[model samples]
Structures are given as C-alpha cells and as structure tokens.
Target: MRYVSLGSGSKGNATLLEHQGRSLLIDCGFSRKTLLQRLELARADAGQLEAVLVTHEHGDHAKGALALCEALDIPLYCSQGTAIKMDWTEHARWRSLTGGDLTRVAGMSVAAVTVPHDAREPLQFVVEAAGLRVGVLSDLGSLTPHVIAAYQGCHGLQLEANHDPEMLRKGPYPPGLQARVAGPYGHLSNAQCAELIRRIDWPGVQYLTAGHISEKNNHPDLVGQALALAFGSTSRPVHLLAQDQVADWCEF
Candidate 1:
C-alpha cells in the first residue's frame, strides 16, 4: 500500500491511499482543480478513484468531497452526523458509516474511530490491507484510549503535530483564538503529540508523517524536537507534510 499527501495544513488537506490497484481518497479539502492536479502529480488518475472517506465536515478536511465524489461518480462514505452537517442529501451517492463500524473496499478494510473535535460527529480511520495497517489521524483534540487502540500497530501512520504551546501563547492571534486552539476540542499541542506517539504501539512502522501544522505557531524544528522526544532518538525516519504542494508517496 502507498499513501500520498495532496497537501496538509490549515489551508487545505487531502490524502490518497492506494492498494491492490485501487485508489481511495481519505479527504478532499482542496478545490477540485487543485486536488485533480495533485492526483496527477501522484500518478493517480482522478477518474479511477474508488471513494472518498470523510473524517469530518470541517472545510479543511472535507469541503471538496461532495463535489469530487459527484464529478467522479463515486461514493462518499462518512458518519450520519457528518452527512447531516453537510446537508448534501441529493444525488444519493452517500455511504453512511457509524462509529466503530468496519467496511471493506478495494481490497482494504477501513474502520471508523470517533475523535474529539469541534464537529458534530468527527471520525478518524484505520485501514488494513494484506496484514498491514495504516492509521490516518488528525484534527483531534486530546488522545483517548480508543484513539490509541485504533492507531496502534500501524505499518505507516500520519499524526498531527499542530502547534507548540509556547509559540501559540506568544503568537499574533487573539486570546479567544488561542484559547480555542489550546482547548480540549481543538488541535493537539506539540508535547501532547509527542506523548501520544510514545504511548502508541508502532515498532514496525516504516514512516511516520507529521501533518496539519500551524504555519504561524509551529516550525519544522519544533516538530523535529517533539518527534525526537517521542522516539528518544533522531535516527528514526519521519516526514513533515506541507500546505503548498503535494508530497511524494510513502510506500510500505
């Protein structure tokens, strides 16, 4: 299996997970044009995409899902709460998945795990194929036992390191925005991210990608330091996602 980040940041975020000759899009935060261009760059034809699995109704996570799914004649799989919030009932290409429900598609099995975020019924995912598992987790607040269980033993994982508390406290944003970011329903702090990684079981993971970074309150250096604390060393391979361009495929 392979995963490619179309982009990852506050501006937009999308990822393509491909396995067994089938391509599945995890999210569609980008505009149609941008996502299609990134798909081409990743060597995945947009016309051949199997489905769009939405995590939440946030614009940076799923703003483009319905349009892309409609354009490509594919299904949009998401929770009932997310569907209700989106209010896109027409055309009837929806696949409703409840929390903790497991479904198989394109030779890969996907399980939805609920997440604590400022959404109606947000969810993250774990995809398993050919004895390997990969977790896609982001836009979450505090990590819970369920999150740890869902993300454990991943062959490849994408985790969010959204910001540094110190930087955010001193950044340009107002007090309310800062409070929202630091709240339990907001993004995770650097320390929280590092600690969560240390708590998970991921010995055989080939790649660990940090994503959904704050352009203002975080830096690559901070993310590296946090990762070092998580692994207790600097020898482990890690990839940092960006908002401007698509990332190369990380295969496992």
Candidate 2:
C-alpha cells in the first residue's frame, strides 16, 4: 500500500491511497482544478480513484468531493449526516455507511470509526488491503478509547496535530474561538496528540504523518518535537503534510 497527501490543513485536506491499480481518495477539500493539480504533483491519476470517502461535511474536507466524484464517475461514501449536510441529489452515486460496518472499496476493506468532531456524525477511516492497514485520524477534538483501539496496528497513520497549546493560548484567535479549539469537540492540541501517540501502537506503525496542522497555531518543528517526546528514544521517521504541496509517498 502506498499513500500520498495532497494537502492537509485549514486551507484544504485530501489524501490518496493506492494498492496495485486501485486507488481511494480520502477527501477532496480543494477545488476541482486545484485537486487535479495536487494529484498530478502526487503522481496520482484521478481516474484511478475507485471511490472518495469523506470524513465530514466541513468545507475544508468535503467541498470538492462531489465535483471530483462526478467528474470521475466514481462513488462517494459518507455518513448519513454528511449526506444530508451535502443535500446531494445524486442519490445513485452516494454510499452511506454507519460506523463499524465494513465495506469494500478499491480492493480494500474499509471501516469507519465515529469520532468526536464538531461536525455531525464525523468519522475516521481504517482501510486494509492484502494484510496492510492504514489508519486516518483527523479533525477530532479528543482521542477516545475507541479511537485508540480502532487505530491500533496500523502500518501507516495520519494523525492530527492541529495546534500547540501555548501557541493557541497566545495566538490571535479570540476567547470563544480559543475555547472552541480547546474544547472536547474542537481539535487536538500538540500535547494531546502526543499523548495519544504514546498510548497507541506507535512502534508497530511503519510511517507517521502529523496532519491537519494549523498554520497559525502550530509549527512543523513543534509537531516533530512533540511526537519525539511521545516516542522517547524509540524514534521513527515522521512526515509532515503541508497545505501548499503534496507530500512524498509512504509505502508499506
């Protein structure tokens, strides 16, 4: 399995996962033109996408999903809440799955795990193919026991490190915005993200990508430092996803 991040941040969020000739797009947050450009940079052909899995209805995650799927003539999967939020009329191409149900997409067995995000019925995905598994956890306020168990044993992980608490505390966001960001259903602080990495099966992971970092509240250096703190002396290669460019492919 190989994965490439098109971009990951407040500006936009998308990832492409491939195995053999099949490909799955985790999100399409950017505009169609921009998504195509990024996919080109990632060396991914959008035509190979078998399906698109949306994490939630947030604009930065789902904004371009339908357009891309329509252009590719592929299916788009999301929770019922997300579908309703989209108000999509293209019922034939939409697949709605409840959390915990497994489905096959592009030769991978996919299971959606409900997550604590501000969006209605948000979900994270764990996809497995040919004995290799990849877990994607992002846009969540807090990490729960369910998150840990669901994400354990992943070969590749894209976890959210949205902000540095100190940066957020001193950042320009107003009081209400700060509270929302730090709230239980907001986003993961760097410290919280590191703690979650510590408790999960990190050693088993072959690749770690700290994703959805805030340009205003978090630094890429801080993300690495925090993750290092979590792994202690047992450090592993970490990849940082950027909002403006595609990340290098991580294969397992």
Candidate 3:
C-alpha cells in the first residue's frame, strides 16, 4: 500500500491512498484545480478516484467534496448527519455510512470509526487492502477506546497533532474561541497526541504522519519533538504534513 497527503492543516486537508489497483481519497478540501494539481504530483488521476470519504462537515474538510465527487462522477460516503448537513439534494451520488460497518470502495475495505468532534456525526477511517492497513485519524477532540482499537495495527498512519497546549493557552485566540478549541470536543494537542501514540501498539505502524497542525499556534518542530519522544529509538519514520506542500509518496 502507498499513501500521500495532498495537504493538511486548518486551511484544508486531503489524503490519497492507493493499493491493489484501487485508489481512494479520504477528504477533498482543496479547490478542484489544486486537487488535480496535487494528484498529478502523485501521478494519480482524479478521474480514477474510487470514492471520497468525508470525516465531518467542517469547511476545511468538506468544502470541496461535492465539487470533486461531482466532477469525477464518484460516490461519496459519510454519516447521515453529515449528509443532511450537506446540500446533498444538489448531488446525485452519496452514500450514508454508519460507524463499525465495513464497506468496499475501489477494492479497499473501509471501516468507519466514530470520533468526538463538534460536528454531529464525525468519523475517522481505517482502510485495508493488499495485506496492508492505513489509518486516517483527524478532526477529533479526543481519542476513544474505539478509536484506539480501530487503529491498533495500521501499517501507515496519518494522525492529528493539531496544536500545542501551551501555545493554545497563551496564543491570541479570544476567550470563547480558545474555550472551543481547548474543550472536550475540539482538536487534540501535541501532548495528548504523544500520549495516544505511546498507548497505541506501534509495531505495525511503519510510517507516521502528524497532520492538521495549527499554522498559528503550533510549530512543526514541536510536533516532531513530542512524537520523537513518544517514538524514542524506534525505527518508524515520523513526518509532518505541511499546509502547502504535498507530502512525498510513501509505500509500505
């Protein structure tokens, strides 16, 4: 299996995963033109997308989903709440998915995992194909036991380390905004991310990509350092997905 991140941050987010002659996009937050360009960088064709999976209805994650699926004539999968939250009557192909059910999309086995987020029915995904497993986890405020179990044996992981707690506390965000971000239903902090990594079974996680970093409140170095401590002396490679640059393709 192979994967690449088109981009990851508060601005937007998308990921491309391919294996066993099938390709899938985890999110489609970029513009159609930018999405095409990023796919081209990975030598992938947008017309070949098997499915588009949405985690939530947040603009940075769901903004371009309809446009991309409509343009490619591909099916979109998300929770009923998410579908209802969308202007789905305007689109023809959409499938509502519930957590814990396994579905095949473009030859890949996709299992949706519920996540705690501000959205009504947000979900993360665990994808398996060609004897490899990839976990896509983001936009969650906290990790549930179900989330940890879902990602227990992933070969490649794109996990969120959205911000630094201290930075968030001392940063310039207003009181209400800060409360929302630091609340139980907000994004994860660097320390929380590191603790989660420490608890997970990491033997199968050969590649780790920290994603959805805060451009204003967190530094890539902080994320790297925290993860490095959690992954001390382990051979696994940890990468930070940039907000602008597309991550290099990695295979497992």
What is the C-alpha local distance difference test score of each model? 0.87, 0.89, 0.86
The candidate scoring highest on lDDT is 2
Cα lDDT tens digits, model 2, 51-127, are: 99999999999999999888889999999999898886357779997889899999999989999989878988999
Task: Compute the lDDT of residue 247 as modeled in candidate 1.
Answer: 90
Better of 2 and 3 by lDDT: 2
Candidate 2 minimal-lDDT segment of 10 residues: 228-237
Minimum summed lDDT over a 10-residue window in model 1 is located at 229-238
Q: What TM-score does structure 3 among the candidates reach? A: 0.96
lDDT of 1 by residue, 135-189 (tens): 9999888988888878888988888999999999999999999988888889988
For each of the candidates, the C-alpha root-mean-square deviation to the true structure, in angstroms, is 1.2, 1.3, 1.3
> Mind giving the per-residue lDDT tens digits that candidate 3 earns over 70-151?
7888899889888889867345688989988799988889999998899978988999987789988988888788888888
Question: TM-scores across all candidates?
Answer: 0.96, 0.97, 0.96
Q: Compute the lDDT of residue 84 as modeled in candidate 3.
A: 84
Sorted on lDDT, best first, the list reads 2, 1, 3
